[model samples]
Target: MKKKFKNLTFKDALFNIANYTVFFLFTLACIFPFYYIFINTISNNDAVQKGMINFIPVGINIRNYLALTSVNDLGVSFVVTVARTVLGTGLMVLASAFIGYLVTKEEMRNRKFWYRFLIITMYFNAGIMPVFLNLSMLGLTDNFMGYIIPSIIAPYNIILVKTYIESIPRELEESALIDGAGYFMVFRKIIWPLSKPILATIAIFGAVNHWNSFIDSLVYMQNAPKLYTLQHRLYVYLNEASNLKDIISSSPNAAAMALNSKVLKYTVTMVTLIPIFIVYPFMQRYFEKGIMLGAVKG
Candidate 1:
């Protein structure tokens, strides 16, 4: 590599510089939002409101976070979010794999019909009004079921898993079947193990979706505040925090109240995003490999 670089022309050097510059800018652009949030979260409330805190935190402060700790429903939202993320991701991955595997089986009756049916949904949008009405009809409103059921089986995820499963040689499962292993046994002992990469990839997708989703919670759980997810609760806090002017006017601790909402907003954002940030690095390699194998290899 050093030898090749030594022989490079001016044009080659220019191209290399341009490539590095573009990537540097892109990386900065991606990182800036988090940095801005971090600096603001740590900075004084007045600094944030005056647009004084930028890339660097101007004045160190933790009052906003202190106030956030005392806020109601924060703990409840955290529990709801964690429960939904774990259960929803597991169920989604299993359902995706089951649907994906079923479609690939040549012997399954109506294989073509099922495959085409699932694929068609991807290209179509069953608008929000219809989806909400259907959920309401099913009595999912004002319940945790509203959070999990709608996203439990994603068509795109199923298609990805299906492609990954198809790439796996079928002879192993067939051999296991010939040896008297039932379909479930073959799937349990063979298919699932081989499909771990793609499953891990889809697991991240499902978990992120479940954790970040607030629209479902808003639309269905408005009447059931106990069922609110962390995102929804955070949304409420952010909105209130942004209106510090109103809060200061009515509060006894007008001086302290001014900083509470704004600071809490930034802290809440960090808290909400913490899980994904913590888990992502570990899953990234598998996610990349799975995407290539499941979505591109076929």
Candidate 2:
């Protein structure tokens, strides 16, 4: 059997065409930079340096990627970045979910005040020096904990989680309590599982932030090369001639091809972005749904 299409009016057809055209162009605009960078990274080093490689690759090879393996501290930096993203995202989601659950409880004393206190920090900035001094005083400076501790309690995430939990029927919690479940058990058995959408959304946010963070490492971990995240190392690799030269010299392919700084920078960027690219597609549905629903009630 043949399926029949509904007839469309001229205005409707025109509108649909315009909408599709606009979105197609917008998508292309978004994808082009990454595409351009990727082709440049794989294209011949001389052409890339001379800006000859544009829409497509020329004399493509994997030398730039192979060269990256030889960078000093690259392995350690990769480890640090992965560790930070995983630990930071997990702790942040848990803290947000727990605190979000707490604030939704009517019986928790001073809940409003505590919520306000947390939200207030989001609005205020104590200059960088003060924050640095505070971290130094607390022994977080030069420590991996510097990344995890400061980001664990994100107020914005808490608000989203709290709002999301509020949208859940109170009858669920009341029924659990009537069954003699304590608040913690009720939360663990009921609320936590239900909040998966928002939690996944927060995890995406936290992971991206942690993965891309370099300023914290730059400021606090300057003396601790062992603690450098991938982004910070990339920053150093781009800016420091000695570091770039040493890294290039260490890679036989990079040395033979004389890979320029531009190729190195683009390759490192794509490498850093690869994990997020792999992860986001799986989580995108939850992200869109959570953000919409989370925003609706609040």
Candidate 3:
């Protein structure tokens, strides 16, 4: 590596410097927002409120986080979000894998028609009011199942899984079947194991969607605050900070009133994002490989 660096021409050296500089700036840009928010949340309430906490913290404290713990309904919102994300991701992965595998079978009746039907839904959606009416008719409105049921079958995820499965050698599955293994057995023992890359890819997608989703809660749980997801609750909390301040000021919770609203907002934002930050790094290798391979063919 030292010898190669010494041998580089002026043009090559300049190109390498430019490439590294661009990537370094881009990475900094992506990371700066989170860092800025974090520093403000830790800064003293007076400094944060006076807008003096940029770039570095001043008189750092953790009161914002402590104050957030006292917010009403936060625990329930958190439980709902966690439950939604876990159940939604697991069920979607299973459904996508099962449907994806089924579409690859030539022996299945009307396979093309069914596959095309699924694909077409990707290009179109009924208007929001019609969807609301449909959900109402199905008795899904104001229900927790409303969050999971509508999202379990995603066409784009199915396509990724189906394309990845098709790339696998058919003989492996054929050999499993030759040993008297049924379709489910072959899937569990062979295909499922071999399709980890694409499955992980879809899992990441499902987890992120379910974690970040608030629209469903906003639309379906408007009258059911008990079923509200964390994102939706946070959305309400942030938007209502002005009105909330007056209420909190009169309350007996000194920690809640002492913390600046902006600081608390930043704290809550970090709370929501920390889980994704922790989980993404472990799955990134699979995510890159899976998306690339899945997109290459379809």
- Predicted structure with the largest lDDT when compared to the true one: 2
Cα lDDT tens digits for candidate 1, 39-72: 8987877778787888778768665555555554
Candidate order, lDDT descending: 2, 3, 1
Task: Provide TM-scores for the models.
Answer: 0.89, 0.93, 0.93
> Lowest lDDT 10-mer window, candidate 3?
248-257
Q: After superposition, how far is residue 275 of candidate 3 from its true place, in Å?
A: 1.6
Predicted candidate 3 versus true structure: per-residue lDDT over 256-289, tens digit per residue? 4465578667877888888888999999999999
lDDT of 2 by residue, 113-209 (tens): 9999999999997978899999999999999999999999999999999999999999999999999999999899999999999999999999999
Candidate 3 ranges with C-alpha deviation above 4 Å:
3-8, 246-257
TM-score, structure 3 vs. true: 0.93
Local error of candidate 1 at residue 192 (angstroms): 0.9
lDDT of each: 0.84, 0.89, 0.88
Off by over 4 Å in 1: 7-9, 59-63, 242-260
TM-score: the better of candidates 1 and 2 = 2
